[model samples]
Target: MKITRRIHSCVEISDGDTTVVLDPGGFGTPDNLAEVDAVLITHIHPDHVDADALTAARATNPELRIYGPEGLRELIDADYNVVADGDTFSLGSLNVEVRETPHEKIINSKELPENLGYLFNDTVLHPGDSMAAIPDMEVVLVPISGPWLRMLMVDEYLAAHRPKRFIGVHDGVDNDNGLTLRGGLLRQLAKDHGVEYLPLKPGESVEV
Candidate 1:
């Protein structure tokens, strides 16, 4: 399988033929939802699941199957298969396992967002905005930029989880100098934890 890094939370994964797009949100344009075999949204947040984009994609590809948290259906009127934690589904030969993880606490008063992580082909795990315990995976799309995150947590998360491959995401917020400096820091950090960090810019794909 190959994972193509998009601008932010959005990522496109395909096994040569069929593709599964994850979190086609506000940071980057996912071109068309019709292109992907399916879409696995992590949450209802616009940054993770842009409703306008999906709605537009569906207009052209009505057969496109969308899967995500059950509550998002109310917010997004689409033909969706609501899924819960630990639920498993398959698209042709592709296998997906849902992991319901608690979103990191950003505020003491506000409730955590319902975040869902996807384990694809038992190899890659894309955790939207959650920094919780990640299941064992060969590669992980680590969120390196967000208001709710810090570099310290990025260091600790990789050190603790220790996936074989580290792919950075959620980095749409970084500026030119910020990306260069932070990219170097993150790459070295991943190496320190014995993980190969691919500095994949937006629209770049890496075969895994």
Candidate 2:
């Protein structure tokens, strides 16, 4: 599979026959959605779910399948599949398993019930904004930094999961403070854990 990092947590995964777009927000404009068969949204944050971009993509491709965590269905007008913890679904050749994420408790809003992480094709795991225990996968998309995710939690997640390859996401852009410190920390952690950690710049692609 070929993984293209658009920006932030947004990525496009193409396995020749099918293309799965994850977190099609932030740097994802309408033009970026071309030829996309499906979109998987991890959360409802604006940085992760730009309404205009998603709406345009859905409008352009009416057959597109949109998937998101629970409570997101009511927020979107498009035909969507709402998934919760332990839900399994498919998009063409890709099989996805949704895992529940603990709420960060930024506010007392009931709207933020649970977060989601996705195991795709059983080979890649995209842990939205949640810390995850490592599963058997060639590549793991790890959230190195975020408003709610702490540095220690990131360290623990990496050490625990220990995937063969790790790509730092949800940081290193847009003046996020953690990004500034995480680059060095991840490098050091990579050495300590004996895993390959890749810090990708925006608009870059990595093959897995």
Candidate 3:
């Protein structure tokens, strides 16, 4: 599978025919969402769900499947699919498992929605804005720099999961100080855990 790391937490994953776009929000472009077969939303944060972009994408590809946590179904209009924790679904050969995430730091207590982290094809895991126990996967997509996750937590999570390859996301847009600090911390943690750590700039693609 091929994964392209878009701006912020957005990523486009494809195995040629079927394409899955995850968290296409603030940093999403019209061109980025053009050929998407499915949309996977992790949370309802502005940075994770751009209404305009999503609408445009849906207009372009009318048959797109939009998947997210349970309550998310009411927020987005379209032929949406609800995916709660432990829920499993498939798009062609790709298998997806949705897991719940804590919204303690990322969102307000009252406004917090059920955030989801996804395990893709049982090979790649995208811990969408959450600190989760990593499943067995070849590549782990982790949020290395974000207001919600501190350096200590990131370090701890990395040590615990210990995947073969780690790609840093949810960064490189705002809060330069936080990004730099987390980047440095992630590098150190990667060395300590003996895992490959890759931090990609927006628009960069990686093959797994």
Per-prediction TM-score to the true structure, in the order listed: 0.94, 0.87, 0.89
lDDT of 2 by residue, 64-163 (tens): 8888976676567787888888899877777889987775655565456457888888888887776676554678888766666676876777678778
Candidate 2, residue 176: Cα displacement in angstroms equals: 8.8
- Descending-lDDT candidate ranking: 1, 3, 2
Among all candidates shown, the one with the greatest lDDT: 1
Query: Regarding lDDT, does 1 or 2 come out ahead?
Result: 1
**Per-candidate local distance difference test:** 0.84, 0.76, 0.78
> Candidate 1: minimum summed lDDT over ten consecutive residues — where?
128-137
Relative to the unseen true structure, what is the C-alpha lDDT of residue 69 in candidate 2, on a scale of 0 to 100?
76
**Candidate 1 lDDT by residue in tens digits, 1-208:** 8888876889999885788899988776677567788988998877887887887787778888899987687667678888889999888767899988888777788776689999888888988888756645688989888778888898998888888887888888889998999998997897788888888988789998
Output the better candidate (1/2) by TM-score: 1
Question: Model 3, residue 112: what's the lDDT?
Answer: 66
Backbone N/Cα/C clashes per model: 0, 1, 0
In angstroms, how far off is 193's CA in candidate 3?
0.9
lDDT of 2 at 136: 49
